[model samples]
Target: MKIKLIAAAAIAALGFATSAQAHKAWLQPSQTVFSDKGAWLTVDAAVSNDLFYFNHVPLPLERLRITAPDGSAVQAQNASTGKLRSVFDVELAQEGTYKIAMVNEGMFASYKLGGEAKRWRGKAEDFKAGIPAGATEVSASESLGRVETFATVGSPTTGVFKASGKGIELVPVTHPNDLFAGEKATFQLLVDGKPAAGLKIEVVPGATRYRDQQNEIHLTSGADGKFEVNWPQAGMYWLETASEDAKTTLPDAKQRRLSYVAVFEVLSQ
Candidate 1:
């Protein structure tokens, strides 16, 4: 089935305490593919950096959802969250691919005094604590962060790679779950359910050892909203893109930025 369009709604994020460093969410599994009849999959997740270990904190379970191998919704079981990490387990019931997605969006305000930008903060409840009394004006905007990944139990399936129709989605022209090092994979960027042309995309090694921003491959989508990249080595990687909207009428800001991220692996030859 093709992607169904859904309106990107703002999440009411109040009383959210965030770390100083920018936190990005990722999904890591004990094994990407299963060979046993009763294999179980374990996953560790967090809004973190420096590889799997948490640099920020764990993402709330309410923000996550999973689609199973046969395209049925699967609930993440035994979920737990702590200061450093979040872990969960999923039991495999089929022999195809499974997809997990986490989405978060909220309103943010930027403080400026005499045209000098001071700070930016999200969650309506943090406004008083974030903005100082001397601030002359405040601009408000909407923001969004999205993450997606896949795991398989035998051969990979394409059911979950279809766009979710909400943000800057990467629709794989080549099968995302069947990538290999040294092979070029193509993807189409869709912004709000339509082709997104001239968008910048970054493909970076997902490991902390190779995560220098200089090592990332940067590409731009063409008129067809498609871009291609070839992995230099076998490893997990992240593909991300973002866009800004200046049409927000929110009381706190003038513009908004939306970002999308996806994680996948390229197998060794």
Candidate 2:
């Protein structure tokens, strides 16, 4: 996975003085789920205060569009949060790739934060729908299963979760049930059908090739074998979980493994 950090230099080069408009970045949604009914596309954007430090007022969204593979345009409404967020809902009846574009509206122009007015543009492509034949769709039940099994057989088993000590377990957490921006949920890894404790975990938001950016989070399992992380913004985030091992341990002992990951949407609340 490609990870791009928005450096201050890059942001400055975009024409904003270092003092104003600290950083401007896009939060791309990682997963798009399609079904016979329609397709659900979730898009997120992240604007740091530093990036907007110089601006007189908050920048508002101007135009947001979604184009289907067949050249059909889907009208996207600014769902919940109006100014600070750029989110859209597009319906898809057929199977194909989709392209989305969002532009910041007049607010930025009026303030003239930068010498030359600029608009934020973001694009998300290949939004897909429908399920493959053999792949079972992820659901709340499946999410529960993985958590249950992981906690049950820790170090002793080949399953993702392994028992590290008498009361501790180590497991890897990844997609299909991974973390997302603006979400608070918990899934556990059981040790012999009991809650495992002190498991270290990391959540990395996925990146998009179109924009070249990514975000990540680090967390730990609680006494109840549950881990909680909140995505403060919208973007594709990758969730990773592993046992905390000492530096003195062998390299193999510290290897990170894939658990389960799922794409999620964070709407304006």
Candidate 3:
């Protein structure tokens, strides 16, 4: 129910920094489940207070990654970053699903120096050199975040859903592009390529500024990391899940925080 705001200075490391505080970072595709091939898709990226709105700062595109249905890398075109949002266009030339994401990895740490508490955030590669030698009571947590959305030109494909074995990711039992209203969809949450059992998932419908309440559907992954969501009605839904554990990829850090978010549009059945 609480939405966290981000300062404009956090734009460079949107993913890692936002995980430390909190922000509704998302990639909103203009359309999903397209009926034809070779279609062009427009996507808007932002960290907003309301779902899918551009009232907040733009999500930087430096981390943007586009994957074609064949698992090949695709570049974003006509990309622009504005005050409140970043927009880009992707050409669906391969005739299957496409994954558009801002994948980020960084380090977040807090420690005591000179009897004063200080914090630092930077790229994972900079963790060792960035920490002061005399810093005491040091605590560091690596962060991996993926803000993504999917689009299908003709038929949906699974290539785009493959997990990177780092952060929390959604493995679809029901294809993201195939979701529908009044029906249940299954998905599995994974962290470091393993099952993320009991992790909490929040799914909220878009256009919430006009609504009285969020109407969020809360779910917990099962023992096998699987969970189900029954769509309340046909609309774009923002799905988010986060976890923190001692699964740090960096030995210097004690823990790692992982977050994954995706936008899915459900059609009327």
TM-score, candidate number 2: 0.30
Give the TM-score of each candidate: 0.77, 0.30, 0.90
Per-residue lDDT tens digits of candidate 3, residues 1-73? 2112112113224643344243578899998977887788999999887887888688889999999999999
lDDT, residue 29, candidate 1: 70
TM-score of 3: 0.90
Q: What is candidate 1's lDDT per residue for 200-230, written digit by digit as tens? A: 7767676664555536688889998999888
lDDT of each: 0.69, 0.35, 0.81
Best candidate (score: lDDT):
3
Off by over 4 Å in 2: 1-22, 33-37, 49-59, 78-83, 103-269
- What value of lDDT does candidate 2 attain over all alpha carbons? 0.35
Supply every candidate's count of residue pairs whose N, Cα or C atoms clash at under 3 angstroms. Answer: 4, 31, 0
Error of 2 at 51 (Å): 13
Residue 203 miss distance in model 2 (angstroms): 16
Candidate 2, residue 233: the lDDT equals 68
TM-score winner = 3
Residue-pair clashes, model 2: 31
- Model 1's TM-score against the true structure: 0.77
